[model samples]
Target: MSKIVYFFCFFFCFGIAQAQDDLLKELDSDSIAKSQITAAAFKGLQICTMQSTKLASKGEWYFLVAHRFGDLTEGFDNFFGFDNALTKIGGLYGVTNWLTVGLSRHTLNKNYELTAKYKLANQEEQGFPVTIVGYNTMDINTKLSTDEFPELKGTDRMAFSTQLLISRKITTGFSMEIVPIYIHKNLYEPLSEEVDNFLLAGGGRYKISKRISINAEYALRLNANDSSFYHNPATIGLDIETGGHIFQLVFSNSQAMNDVSYFTNANGISDGKGIYFGFNLYRVF
Candidate 1:
């Protein structure tokens, strides 16, 4: 009887140990799988006026509204430039964890844009120190009139921009991004120097609180011609987060909303003029 009891106890102890070992192995595997990906390097799809490394999750949708008031220096006559606002309304949908597609329309040039973004690499946990994304945008100038150019073709109203976004979250409170951009215009303004434009843009954000951040961005046109009236665009802003929305208030030297217009058609920046107020609101679903 005693030998039988001892054998039974040994088997029961062995089974319990085996089950614990299995549970531990399963937990380890779960940890490994969950640790392979990092999340939320940025809270919004845009850092300010430029695209950020952030993307919507699969099946999620985002709506963006951007408004740029006319130069604030216009004073009370223009109600602090509120009377001459240019607005952009857009929507983006995530097709997958790493891909998003969007469309937007800007009042500045009566421009419509189709945009796509792909995450090439993610920062940390994926053996990468920085996140990389590819962005492509195609814009159509619907406001172009045959009266301005009797020989204008449909293709002449098309413009395209390609950008590589590289970003790093240096710390829990600070993040930065560098963008290398190429823009192509099917047709330039009369006597304009270049149809192809090269630009380098940099942007950064610092978290001031759990729900607020300070942001800044600048785009420098590398191949700007002497006759080009555009100047380097720079902006400073604050981002406020509330529930499922983010609100951005900014001051910038550029009035146009689209990349081509803001980067190439910007005027009155040379002598400290053309500083405008702008805001962006994002709603996520």
Candidate 2:
């Protein structure tokens, strides 16, 4: 289970690996030890910046432990709330300066999903400030009731998604990313009515300071009466960097953290009063 809190943060760490060689050359000339520089580079996750520009001998890897609790329906008197819990492990690797690859897995509410992300433009000075393109896919492997699958033999269709992240450096230690997304489902059905099988979304992340950042994202359905996707989805969270690990604590209307669910499935109904809970834990190694 590699996909944890926010897949993007883990991917950001890989940017440093791509420039390790030149960085080593320049810094070594200035009397810096490779080990020391590397250690410092790893620790510098506290800041949103790159450490190097090449795939050095050594790269980075990390895992995550996550817990999420929420309910789309909430009531103390009636208390007919639906809860969701998740646990996952995720990581990223550097391929070149401003480019990295990432993988993650999330298990929550009986659904298992996988994700991958690739940074297309992080250190660019062209059409966009910082742009990243990525994708995710999830299979509904949860057990089924006898009536749903009396003798289940075939595989269920998967949910697929893609995102284009555009961000900018606001200042010294602050940056933000605007994410535009698309989602597709092989089969979508609703109990009461038919729902759309696709979704469109937008979201962003902001650095609050050197070690903390804020994130707020939202999605709107293109299909007018799509019950398969959320009517509207939004998320707000904070990012904390700790040495070799980066942790993100988030609050989202949608319990799905990875792209397939979080970016696309969040309808955020119940008058935006759907859930009142938190999503915890994340990191980069």
Candidate 3:
């Protein structure tokens, strides 16, 4: 099974690398002509566990693979959570220069997500100080069992989130972003009757070299219930660009990657004991 997976990854990445070169050349030509606009604030489409202001260019496609292993505190007994890894695979396409859409499936909770992101504005070198983007996602929980609920409805399995991303390139080697988010859950957890939640997430990145950067992010759940057992999500990551693709190594306190769960359902503790190690890989064509 591992061999099969490796073969599939190599097949697509190798094949796409050649075609991507042509597309990138054309893209570079266009981008270089825009002298007033600021350059990209983030290298990858994501800054650690949160979405970055970066968007796929028109007609571009991106393939993403993300993994979150089990609790690292479990020690060598669980092989540092490698034995209980959760995988997510997805693809995104740019409908236009400013609009992008994506779909993904996750192993945790058998969740499926449909996402849309659109650029609202861009930072200008001497004008606007920030770039703005809008992001929304709808989640479907397929693992819900009628046997457990005895009254499960299609609506009960649905969840949604919307966010406004604001980012700025502070300097040549530094960037930061803030996101105001809204989340709704059709079926609330048994512990709380609230169906709506609000959060504020923030993150930043600093370039260390030509090919490496350090990134970190954290989300604060504003309306969390006092009785709830979940903790806020926090993550630190290292981004490595290898010419053809980007690789991200992550240390996070959350295992849920879906936007809805990532903001509202993180269960890990903030302390080092509950950390979960993960990685995200992205390929473009």
Candidate 4:
């Protein structure tokens, strides 16, 4: 009788210990899953003209406004570009946490654009090293007219851009991104630009404080002609977070905001000559 009692007690304690260990293992697995993803690499949806890995939350709506003033090289002659400002206005909707859709109109070429951005992968704290996002846009140039080219077709006025955005958060306050871009235009000046172009773009951001940061970006055309009038696009900017909106003050060599134009046709040099000053504002609802 005594031996049986001791055996029963031992079995009961063993079962309890086994259940506790399993519970702890389950909790650890949950913790690892929750902490596997790294923090956001950027605050704004864009790192300069290039798109960042950031995405709006599900069901969120964003309103965007941007202005690229005339060349600052014109100085007072153009009131530092205020007199010839080009404006872009757009809206973005987060269809899901991993997908966003946007539409916008630009005054630069009387262009309208439709865009889709989707998340492919996310940076993991100890697993994957980078986050990947895909971006694609279709541009419609309303400024094109039969008056300029009588043979122009509807397809001739359209352009497209596709990009792969890869980024990593290096530290608590520093982040970097690289993008491989392809642009297609149905009609272009053969003497200067290509109907299909490829470019590699890089950009980075450094946070100085919680509300402000410094950012820079540059793009290189992989197959640009030496005789072409276009230069590579480069930009530097400051980002300010105001309560509920993000404001960016930018100085870029390219004045055209459309992706098809921005990456392929820079009007100025990065050395600061002919630079255009601009600002981008975003509000979320």
Question: What TM-score would you give candidate 2 relative to the actual structure?
Answer: 0.63
Tens digits of per-residue lDDT, candidate 4, 196-238, equal 7877789999999999999999998877866799998999999
Candidate 3 Cα outliers beyond 4 Å, as residue runs:
1-35, 270-272
Pick out the ten consecutive residues of candidate 1 with the lowest summed lDDT. 1-10
Query: Candidate 1 on 184-226: residue-level lDDT in tens?
Result: 8998864554687777799999999999999998988877777
**Error in Å for residue 232 of model 2:** 1.2
lDDT string for model 2 (178-248, tens) is 44444555545454222223334444445566676665556654443533445466666666776655665
- What's model 3's lDDT at 17? 55
- Model 2 alpha-carbon drift over 4 Å, by segment: 1-58, 72-84, 89-105, 125-128, 138-140, 145-147, 150-155, 190-200, 224-229, 267-272
Better of 1 and 3 by TM-score: 3
Best by TM-score: 4
**Distance from true location, Cα of 261 in model 4, Å:** 0.8
Candidate 4: where is the Cα deviation over 4 Å?
A: 1-35, 270-272
Query: How many residue pairs clash in all the candidates, one count each?
Result: 0, 16, 0, 1
Q: Please give the lDDT score at residue 81 for candidate 3.
A: 94
Candidates in descending TM-score order: 4, 3, 1, 2
Per-residue lDDT for 256 in model 3?
82
**Candidate 3 similarity to native, TM-score:** 0.86
